[model samples]
Target: MSEQELIYLLALQKVPNIGDISAKKLLRTLGSAEAIFKSTKKELKLIEGFGDLKINSIHDSSYMEEAEQELLFIEKENIKVRYFEDRNYPDYLKHCIDAPILLFQNGNIDLAHKKIISIVGTRKVTTHGVAFCEQLIEELAPLNPVIVSGFAYGVDICAHKAAMTHGLQTIGCLAHGLDQIYPKAHAKYESEVMDHGGFMTDFWSGSHFDRKNFLKRNRIIAGLSEATIVIESAEKGGSLVTADIANSYNREVFAVPGRNTDQLSKGCNNLIKTQQARLLTSVADLVYVLNWDIQDQKKQQTQLFVELSTEEQFVFDTLKKLGKSEVDVLALQCKLPTFKLNPILLALELKGVVRPLPGKQFEVI
Candidate 1:
């Protein structure tokens, strides 16, 4: 956008009580932020949500000063800003009613033609939760989904790390401004994260750090993806809050189930029992429920020429014939011992030629 348009937008954003929804309404009515400022009081009053106070705030000169100062910061830091209505803004997030009118981003984020999933859970994650988070990302790497999470401790960081480890793009949704990283201990991961994906936030520069910011940040995590996964959470936590937001947005939510007695499992268990989320055990549950067709002809065409050993070819041919079948059934048909078949299956899986289903079933991707 032009410098004048950005200045007007920033000034409009500083207006009290003019949130994203109201701002959009005004934009639709007045045609541009510059027009909104120049329009008479009668024009502003015509918009449904613009009350006397809100309309008056738009005329305040101080807001322009604040916007100018913020503009300086944006230029100085070389920050990238996204207008909500712009084509470059996240597509899913654009549908959210409360999505920010403006968002700040840093790093190499590319969401084009990609599957995005948000993984969140309790900050005090259990060993099982960590393992599941890592394994889930590893398994999903081939499809090249963008992993998203708050850059907090435990589960969020674990999800980001796992995604990064597997060479997948991972977005860190920050609760505060991009001017600094929270949980200062995680500073070490900043450069690596920027190289792969990046951090995003609506919070402005110099905004005070507060615990409450995280609750507000949760909406971005929920809005950006087609689905949200809660690895583990206590009865009440930010991760559960994200799941709730995802449900509200009509996006799919999946929770990893645990024993009823486990403390961190309560949130996930309740979500399942209440039917707020689907139960997730492995990548298969997600693949099946989301109906993600990894067997796209384009994806398959890229791998059709992969070299395979005679044994591996036999296993692949068997899997292709049956579509998907239990390992024992495949072994019986191929006349190979199950022990020998297992290694062949593992090698195929590593080569991204096959994927395991919930039982002992396997399918060619």
Candidate 2:
């Protein structure tokens, strides 16, 4: 359970073709990875799946050599490493069939028993899909649910950005090792997420973003969260893999409804019609299904109106004192220029710090 021991275990785990299930089986019978490491070829042969030929591979020296640089890097970066046996390792992820033997995490990791809702879908969602995800995520974000996603483009990016806009914590499950980002475009968002109490993944430094690894990564995405939502995906999109895995794990799967004839909505409709996923049409449905504390949060929200720019404070106070009103009324009340006030209203609305009603009207909703 010590860091050094876990590192050795993870190195063994990182061995090509050697998986967590087999490693755990060996550990259960033999005790620690240290013990497993000490075991001679003949003794390893006693385990069911650890054949003599495989046992011959047990004492292989490449593990230490392959992991030397990663160990050094981890030590240098001061990254927190947790193993399967560590209490800090997420319990939900532990329940999966092949959870990582060790995770190399680099950020604020909140394992609190909050509602975790994963949003995933096509990396090439349409404009409609983007808007759908944005509004839904915007509504759900204020409740402080733990958001999870693959950190890919389109819907994944949309969910993370939307959650972040509302100051929500969002974890990204990367397909490759934690050492590198696959899609270099997401670097800045990744940094923001890490700063805002989100977490990275399990693989070692040198793991590649291979096709099979992405498939394997889907299990963690499904297992770590309370529910998975498919925002928009074509029939053959990869996001469905996460939904399927979530279902197999007896977890909830939800999908946003899209136009029937739209090809991108095909996967979502398939999930809903086949009972693979629940249809989510509004934020209320998600909050209720997830049993999030939207009402409680609203009641607790004090409307401190702190950290406001001079203009924000002016607009905010005007609305606070007055009952329901229009944006123009507030603009007149604040006496601020239209350019500045409009964007501020939008920002506040997105944060749920303020809201807008129909008919050029604005009020807290």
- In model 1, which residue pairs have backbone atoms overlapping below 3 Å? none
Could you tell me how far off, in angstroms, the CA of residue 302 lies in candidate 1 after the best superposition? 6.8
lDDT string for model 2 (94-199, tens) is 8887888877677776877777788999999899888878777666654677788888888888888888888888888888777787689888777888876565
Clashes of 2: 0
Tell me the number of clashing residue pairs for each predicted model: 0, 0
TM-score of each: 0.87, 0.80
Cand. 2 TM to true fold: 0.80
Against the true structure, whose lDDT is highest? Answer: 1
**Candidate 2, 321: how far from true, in Å?**
20
Candidate 1 ranges with C-alpha deviation above 4 Å: 297-365
